[model samples]
Target: MTDRTYIDIHVLHSVPPSNLNRDDAGSPKQAVYGGVRRARVSSQAWKRATRVAFTDELHLPAEQLGTRTKRISSLLARRIAARTGLDDVAAARLGTALLAQDLNIKAGKKETETAYLLFFGINQLDAIIDLIAERAEELAALADDALTKAVADLPVREQLTSGHPIDVALFGRMVADITSLNVDAATQVAHAISTHPVEIEFDYYTAVDDQKTAEEDAGAAMIGTVEFTSATLYRFATLGVHQLTANLGGDTNAALDATRAFLTAFVRSMPTGHQNTFAHRTLPSLVSFVVRDDQPVNLVSAFEKPVRSRNSGIAEESARRLAKELSRAASSWGVTPLAVASVYEPNSDQNTDTLAAFGVPHSLDEAIASVLQAVRGRLQEPA
Candidate 1:
């Protein structure tokens, strides 16, 4: 087995009548899995939700996160102007030149727009500004041709890779124009799908103008139908600890902190697709984390056969199935996890016996702390 380490997280959550993720027609997103229609939430949506949680709930430093945008020129221009004491016009011009030379990106019709959207962290932006200010005198003296050449020669890739943001390091970056700047994602999130077969249900209703009383207007002002579904969803995500460490330039502490933050945020965050219409804010009924030295395992196969709800409900059945599958996999594959932790909603009918059989923690706080410690212990070990 390889020495590389990995963290796998599994979650079982149930949402009420709500359209958490929708398609183009404003219907809940779905897919045919295991020969049955299953409600689906794209990985992108959950990832965004987790990122938002990082900011809103965890209160992580904004500078340690990355931003995705096509208007990178404008973002950099404002930073350049603030740092270099240059006017907006001059700073913007310099920012455009620096990006064009370094990233090989052509500005679009709009001065702020780039050829494609770019993902960058604050650290990278600061490095670019510093480089510009360092050679301000030289740049001021050079002609257009010489200035372009000098800017191109600057170590743009090196700067971007250093002091990388936690989110950027985890999610990764891809600069089509500059392949060398690309950072492979250290995390993987699977599309959350209902454990049981799902059928879309529509709610039809009408709106009467508030200003028009019953006597003023007998007819309704508007009418529409909203699609929704309620199901127990299976959400899985994995973090490649070795890759995360590499992405953060071998900073294991930062990787551990990120892992902890992600664990809490992912469990608490809820997608707001139709929150105004259907306020279905719910937490995971079950949460599990396994730190392994082998490979990342996704136990979604447990749900391949649709789960039938009993008196305990679908969420309880889903949790039991997951725990059983995980146990079986470990026994058959000779898998040995460094640490394992789990949490179950106290009031739920779900049985915690299966997870307890694996020596998993019952408290969420204990579980998170255990996983973080395990990661730190592994990193400190000599190869």
Candidate 2:
């Protein structure tokens, strides 16, 4: 068997004065790394952005992606009613009964809501709705307790177990009440942190009413202050090929496609927080893909001591540090990665020599293709 265990992606991207992610106080998030304050973008925010890119950039079908919401019961009830010729009221009652009895997922404070958000496949919902519709007449007439018990023995949970959505398989699902329904995530995304110390900056200004004259409105119609920061962030993510293939039901082709889509999402996606005001939609300057048989390695340690540049821009220096760190790590660990590919764009310009570890100059598309080629060769090798 091939010993490959993980595919790791490292990125160095720069964003202008923007709050790509914010805390409760409406200030940009910060993390003290290496004894210095660094601008931060939470992993959750980036993961959500990746999911959105699956639809917006890749245009994958609904069946390939899942929906996330707290009102899953209501959504399922509506679908069940539409497909089963049952009334909405009856569907609501029946939906809650079967879900509680068979799945053990109880309804929340709101009858049609769950205690937490559920991420599930679109096709999986249809399978469930159809399962309910199969015995709608009998199930609807039964008492709540009886309906719960009657459906408890059904194969409802199996529907959820099968046909895992790409996002669901990658990011995973947590069914608190029903542990059997949970899918282990195949990917790990690290929070993006600046490669240098950062200070939060504030933009304080006043807005004047356009229609009202200065004589009538005085100095201004409104006044406010906004917080933001700019930095070159070092981001990382790792994916387990084994876990992904298992989640995809041993379908290697599907796993490969998912891998490609994932690479695209992570490379291209951007968090949209305050995007309208700041428009902080910048691409990464350097991206490297590493496939390893050993454990995934993160290159964030390269920036443990913040990089400094004198008006030449920090991306080049940052890339130099990252490249050196990866080389040193591989040497120190005595574990060579199975394959590596990259596209470097220091100053938003692409090149091959920006990092010696990554050989040829490749566009983003070519880099993804390279990783996939390496993965397929390794996975398909004869044991």
The whole-model C-alpha lDDT of candidate 2 against the native structure comes to 0.86
Per-residue lDDT of model 2, residues 1-383, tens digit only = 43457999999999999999999999999999999999999999999999999999999999889999988788878888888878988888877775676576765788667878888998888887777677897788888778777888767788889899999999999887789999999999999999999999998979978898656847777999999999999999999987887788877888899999999999999999989889899999889999998799998999999887876668888888888888888889876778889887544453435477766558999999989998886564323
TM-score of 2: 0.94
Which stretches of candidate 1 lie above 4 Å from their native place? 134-143, 345-352, 357-360, 380-383
The candidate maximizing lDDT is 2
Candidate 1, pairs of clashing residues: none
Worst lDDT run of 10 residues, candidate 2, spans: 345-354
Location of the lowest summed lDDT over 10 successive residues in candidate 1: 346-355
RMSD of 1: 2.4
